[model samples]
Target: MEIMNNDAVRNVVNDVSDQLRRALFQAREVNAANYIHVVLDPNHPVAPFDSLHPDHLEQRVPSVKFHRSMRADFQHQPELCPLVVTLYSPGDRGYRDEELLLETVDNAVSRCASVNGSYVCGWIATTLNGEEFARHIAVSSILSHPLSGRKVLPWFEPHRLALIVDRYPSFAWSRLTNISSWWFVDMLQQLRVVSPPEVGRNNIIDARSTLLPLSGRQVSAVWDDQRRIREAKLVAMAMRKAGLSLPEFPEVTLDKVVRQAYENGLYGQQDVVFFAMNCLTLSEDWFLHPVVQAALEALAGTDELTLTDILAGHSDAVLHEIASYESAGSAPK
Candidate 1:
C-alpha cells in the first residue's frame, strides 16, 4: 500500500464515494444487493441519519433487530447503533424509494472524512436480505476471546480495517467476508476490497456458531494495535497544541519520536504525550542534553515528581539552552 500525503487524505471521501458507485453497479450486474454498514459516532458534529427521511430509515433493518442478541452496551443506544442501509437495483421492489434514499446516503458518505470524524465505515455487496446482512455485521463486530469471553473489535472502522486485514489471522478474515465482497477505506484513505475465499463461497453456516476465539498472540497484537492507535492520537493532539502541521512533523518523524519516548521508559499516556510535544517544539534529540537526561532519571527514580511536573519545572531559558545545543550539534557540518 502506498502512503498517502495530507492532500490524498482529504480526497478519501471522494474515493469512497467512487468505490460505492462502482460496487453498486457491480452488485446490480450480479443480481446482488448493496448494503452500507455505518457505525455512528454520537459525538460527531454532523448526524448523517438526521438528513434522511423517516421512511428511508424505516426501510433499513432496525438496529435493535440485529444487535438485540449482542451484549455490547453501545448497541442499546439509538445514536451509537450501527445502521445497515440496503440498496436494490432498478425494477426491484421498493427500488424507487431506495434510489432517493441512496442519493441522500451517498451525499452523506461523500462528505465523510477522518479529519471530521467519519461515521460511514464500510459497505457490503451480498445476496442476503437486509436483516441477514445486518446479522453478519453484528456477529462480526464482537469476537470471542479465550480469556475475556467476548471483546468488541471495531474492525469495520475505516482506519482499523487495514490493521485487521493485515495482522488478523485467516479465520478472522473468513468470518468478515460476505457472500460477494466487503469494501472499506483503509487507514491510508485508499479503498480496499476483501472477497470471500472460493472454498467458503457456498458455505451458509451461521457465523455466531463459527466465531473463533482469539489466540494469545492475537490478543497481544490487538492490544498493541490499540495502544499504538492511542499513542498516534496523542501525538496528533500534541502536534496541534504546538501549532505544528503534518508537513512540519511528518508521520515518519512522528513515529520515530514516539519510539524514542517509549525507549526512554515513558509509557504513561501523559508522559509520552509530554515527551512528544517537547520533541516537536524543540529538536527530536533534545533529550540528549544533561538537563533532560537528569529529568528522565528523576522520573525513573523514587522522585515524587511526575515526568510532566519535572519537565514543566524547567525554566524556558534552560529548556531553550538545551534545544539550542542539540540543534547546533546535530546540524550538518
Candidate 2:
C-alpha cells in the first residue's frame, strides 16, 4: 500500500476521529483506558491482531474489544478495516497496559512497513472522560528507532540529552547527587543508543558512533563544570555518610581528578564503564576521580550501599585520609 497523500489522510482522519472520540468517551465513563489505533490501509497484508503479543488480546480486564471498520469492501470479504481500536481496562495494572498497547501497535506498524506502500499510524492515551494524558498521531514510518525490536514512540527514549532531561527522572536526581557515572549507561540500557552486534561480537562494546565528543578533552568548560560539580557533591555526601566531617565542596575540589580525567581522555561513554568497573573492583590504577574514590571508599566492603551509608562508617579514618591527602598537596597516585 502506498502512503496516503495529505488529502487522502485528512479524509481518513475525519472518518475515524468520531469513532475514536466515542470509544474514548465510553472508556472514560467506565474509568478504563483504551488504545485507539488508526491505520491507513484496511487490507494491508499484515493483521493488527497478529502483530501484538497473544496476551494483549487475551481477556485481562472487565472487557476487551477489537473493532474494525472501513468505507467499502474490496473483495467478497468485508474490506479490512483501516481502523482497529482496542478498548481495554487500565484498571490497577500501572504502566503495564500502556506498555503493551504501544508495543503491540509498534509491532504491527513494523510489519506493515516491510510491505510495499505508505501507511499512517497513530494512538492516544486518555483517562476515563477525565483527562487526556497524551494524544499523538504522526506518520509512523518517519518515527522509528535505530534498534529493531525494542521500539517505542518518541519522548519514550532518552537517546538524546534533551530527551534524557525531559523523560528520565534519574537525570534530575543525578543533578543533586552529582553522579554522571550512570547517565550514559542508562541511555544504553534504555535503548536510547543502539549497539550493533559487530561491537559485541568481539566482546567489546564500542559506542563511538552513538555518543558524541570522543574524549573529555573535547568537552566544553560548562559541561565539564556541571559534571565535576555533581561528582564532587556525590563524593562529599559519601564521605559525610562514612562518618567523616567534610564541608560541601560542590563549588570547589575534585578539580585535580576532573582535569586528569580530561587529560586521560576519559569523557566518552565507554570511559564511564571503565571507571565504574575499576571502582567496583578497586582496581590498582585508580583511573576514577577522587570524588568517585571517596564515594566508593565510603561504601567499602558492602553488599548493597546506599546514600545513607555516607553517615554510618568510621568517620575519623575517612576524614583523616581525605584531609591528610589534601594537606600533603598530592593527588591520588
Candidate 3:
C-alpha cells in the first residue's frame, strides 16, 4: 500500500520467486511473491535453457521446467526470456541497487507513457495500478505456472527495451505500435489466468509443446484474439460508466490508451498524441489517465468528493509534476 518504494517492489518480486519454489515442491501454489520461470527451447537459437539461472539460487528453492515449445508464439524469443530478474527481493541483501532499479522502472513506466509506439507502456501502467494486479501478480509464470511447458522470462525494463528498439525496429516496435493495446493486455491477462486457449481440441495437442512454436506474427495474433476483443468491450464499458469521453476509433479498443502515450506522450512525447489516439483506445489494463489516478491517490480516504471532481481541474504545476515524474523515478520526492 505504501508508494511502490524500491524495497517493497523488490520484496514482491522476491516473494514471487519463493512462491514459485514452494509451489513446485508441494505442487501447492505459485504466487508472484516467489519466483518465476522461463522455458527455453533446446533447439532454439538462443541462450541455453539448462543453466539460465545460477545454481546457488536453484539450491535455495525447488524449481521445475517443462522443456518444450508452447503453443503460443513467444516460445523461441531469447530477449523475452528471464533476462535476469533481480534475484533477491528488497527484503533480502540482493536488492543493493533498489534505488537505481526503481529509477529504471520509473524511467521505463514514464517512457512507455511518453512513447505510444509500444503496448508495454499500457501493460506496465496497468501493473503499477494494483487492484487490477493484486490477485494475478502471484502467478509464477507470466501466463501460467513456471513449469507450464511454456517458456517464461522476466519482464523487460523500459530503457532496456528502448535501447534494443533500434536493433529490432521492424520486429519489436512494429509489434508494439502497430498492434492493438487490448491485444497485448488480453494476452497479458490471459497469461495470468488458467491454461492458454486451445490450439486444437479433441485431437489433443499439448499446449505446453506448441505454445512457443508460434511465429512472431502468430504470437502477435493475440492482438486480435477473442479474449482481447472481450477486454476491449469491458474497457469501453468502464469509460462509459464513468461518463468519460470514449475514443472514436475501433469500438472499445486499446488504441486510444496507446495513442495517448504516443501522441501527447503523456509521459512526454512532444505531440504525437493526436496521431496515436487516432489508432487505438484503452489497453486491457485500465491505467486511467495518470491525472485521474493521482487525484484518486491524493484524496486517500476523504470519501467526500468523487474522482471525477478531483481530476476535473488541475493547475500548470500538476503538468510539471507529471513531466518530472515521466522523466525520472518520480519528481525529486
- How does each model score on lDDT? 0.56, 0.33, 0.30
Q: Order candidates by TM-score, high to low.
A: 1, 3, 2
The better-scoring model by TM-score among 2 and 3 is 3
lDDT string for model 3 (74-124, tens) is 445533322222322212333333333333223222222221222121221
Is candidate 1 or 3 superior in TM-score?
A: 1
lDDT of 3: 0.30
lDDT of 1 by residue, 27-85 (tens): 66664343433333332334445544333455554322122223265656655555555
Measured over all alpha carbons after superposition, the RMSD of each candidate to the real structure, in angstroms, is 6.8, 20.7, 18.1
Worst 10 residues of 3 by lDDT: 182-191
TM-score of each: 0.62, 0.22, 0.25
lDDT of 3 at 199: 29
Model 1 weakest lDDT span, ten residues long: 62-71
Per-residue error (Å), model 2, residue 323: 12
Model 2: runs farther than 4 Å from truth?
Answer: 1-52, 59-153, 158-271, 276-333
